[model samples]
Target: MARFRLLADEHQARSPLRQLWREFARQHSAVAGLALFSAFFVLAIIAPLLTPHAPYLQNDNLLLLPPSWSELGLVQYPFGTDDLGRDMFSRFLVGTRYTFGIAVITVLGALIAGLLLGTLAGMSRGVKSSVFNHILDLALTIPSLLLAIIIVAILGPGLLNTIWAIMLALLPQFVHGVRNAIAEQLNQDYVIAYRLDGANNLQVFRRIILPNIWERLTVTATMALSTAILDIAALGFLGLGAQAPTAEWGAIIADSLDLIYVAPIGVALPGLLIFLAVLSVNLVGDGLRTAVKKRREN
Candidate 1:
């Protein structure tokens, strides 16, 4: 009887997750976006094996060479070399690691921090909640990119500083979002019933609030991820994020600006990669929102 009950409990635990996956899979754009992002992640993991040359290795012989298919191109240099004779393809693969790594770190940091602070504010009485919301609103009044830039400037230029700056800039959005979502859930009839039935705050949050608000949280995280990627690239372009010799997508474009007339592909390739990453992320975010809405309606 004990073993059977455990099995039943496990199945019950898995049911909602399974249903969520089914709903998410029904969105074709989400699937495509997930697949493309997964490919980028896989390539990032196996970058050493895929890269023909080191990202920073200068090859004088291959300077300004176009892609392999182009006229006068070499097969060894699949995506050709930049003005500095470094392999574009290798840099791209390696850059994916940095770009994705920073974005993931900042997003997770902001999300976790936001969840904690938001919960506190949401569960608080009138005065505390008002104060928290006021602070958040003040932060939000400054555009995220501008706020990040200001923070980066104060901290000085570097990848680590950029991550911190971006994380801070993004925190207000998450906190505000989570707070409102939590507040709304708290006012729901089911939540009140749970509370009236002698459930503690933690119990109510875990069983009622979290399950209800997680879909919105997932969508917010996805959207923030895309924004982080774009901001990272933008900062790198402005010489405030990834520095010289770093195989970052934005830095690649920044370094290749001088070569635009001579080696147009160098600038074009990294820009294209940035565009695709943001687009895929946005598609996934939109798809998730749509899926969740449809699920709720059904």
Candidate 2:
């Protein structure tokens, strides 16, 4: 079996992505995490078509029903209903879209902003570098959640404002990490050789620095994705994000808290989703880091 697996891997090594997948699949936990995350993401994408009923529609007759597995469960209302008689299963499916969308948008926005700023800071000298360093230091002084709260407070509570706040709060981490990585690469022999070979700053950065730092940036971005999800959920839980009737994970959990005794699954389901999302992202990040380290050593 081992020999056949090795032969199969060698046969599939024609594509870089395939090779990376093989390496990544070696970690059982990472593969499991990826599967779980992908399943949720797919469910979120197709939620509108798959949801049994409108998430916001209320059915007073079915209020506080238990899950289908419970003795009190109804077949039509599989996951049960909220206090307001909204379908829990449908709302949960729809909520996945909101939660995943916010996390992806926030992380991508922060990553782009961080890349631009980090590159500038890393390439700058003397006063320019000093200024950026101080600014990053100031941003990093406060915790990300607190910073997000402050921004949200200033900007007023809303979904877009919450995303922007989370982006701002996460910006310093990417900037700092990327800046140091680029700075180190700048001093390397290849960079010096590129300069000696008459390569311009743009060429050097495009061909050399960017490729080398990509894996690190990917690792950072994956970890940041988890943080973004948590921050958005926190904001939603505190009434600063997504707002009411939006079917967001955190908001769902928050709204169901009052009915814990009557409908524990209402609270537990959303919370479980959040936990799984974070855990999957973290696992993928760890796997990427390990894979990158092994590749570098080889």
Output the number of the lDDT-best candidate. Answer: 2
Supply the global lDDT for candidate 1: 0.88
Q: What TM-score should be assigned to candidate 1?
A: 0.91
Q: Kindly list the per-residue Cα lDDT of model 1 for residues 4-95, writing each as its tens digit.
A: 99999878646766666778898888999989877776766777787878899997777888889998888988888887788888899899
What would the TM-scores of all predictions be?
Answer: 0.91, 0.93
Off by over 4 Å in 1: 1-14
Relative to the unseen true structure, what is the C-alpha lDDT of residue 162 in candidate 1, on a scale of 0 to 100? 96
For each of the candidates, give the backbone clash count.
0, 0
Return the top candidate by TM-score.
Answer: 2
Please estimate how well model 2 matches the true structure, expressed as its whole-model Cα lDDT.
0.89
- What is the per-residue lDDT of model 2 for residues 151-234, given as tens digits with 9 covering 90 to 100? 999999988899899999999999998899999999999899999999988998899999889889999999998998898889
